[model samples]
Target: MKITLIIPTYNAGSLWPNVLDAIKQQTIYPDKLIVIDSGSKDETVPLASDLKNISIFNIDSKDFNHGGTRNLAVAKTLDADVIIFLTQDAILADSDAIKNLVYYFSEPLIAAVCGRQLPHKDANP
Candidate 1:
């Protein structure tokens, strides 16, 4: 299936590379990867440019609303059969992470799917 991966980022900082690297190693490569940047003052764009299948969309930070900002990215993927949304803070656990989510679509009844969000390793809890 044609899939589009969208990431919303703002000053992603040092952790961004890990996320990008994990995405690059995904077992099921996305047909397209769109980064909806909320005016990052850092190197997020420069770092993300090193990867293929990625596109960047910049917007003012004040305009960002978690839901609507993501919706904007979805609208850009009108041709995609499935749209996956990931945040810059997310570190993909394995190459199959995306594949695991996309696998459900074959069932025909699953309209959308999402993975569990795990706490960072250093979390207080």
Candidate 2:
């Protein structure tokens, strides 16, 4: 089973390093890591390039929306069996998150499943 994890970023900077590290720690690492950046002025490109497992798609446009960038990333992975959409700031809690997601799909009736998201201490309710 091929899983494509798409991360939408814009000036994410060091935040992306943690996210990618978490992905690497996952029990089921993604087949591909696609980053859809909206022309970040920061060192996002260089940072992503340094990572061995990441494949970045820098989306250049005058006006960049999160939804639009996400759509473009999804469009690029047309052949993937499963697409996992994640924000640049989000870090996976457990290594089995990806494995769990794919396991649920073993049931033909289950087309989709969303895991619980715990808010960070700094995050507001």
Instruction: Name the candidate that leads on TM-score.
Output: 1
lDDT of each: 0.91, 0.80
Q: Could you report the Cα RMSD, in angstroms, for every candidate shown?
A: 1.4, 1.8
Please report how far candidate 1 places residue 92 from its true position, in Å: 0.8
Task: List runs of model 1 lying over 4 Å from the truth.
Answer: 123-125
Model 1 lDDT at residue 72: 93
lDDT by residue for model 1 (1-125), tens: 99899999999977799899999999999999999999999999889987788889999999999999999998888999989989887889999999999999999888878798787775346
lDDT of candidate model 2 versus the reference: 0.80
lDDT of 1: 0.91
- TM-score of candidate 2 versus the correct structure, residues matched by position: 0.87
Structure candidate 1, residue pairs in collision: none
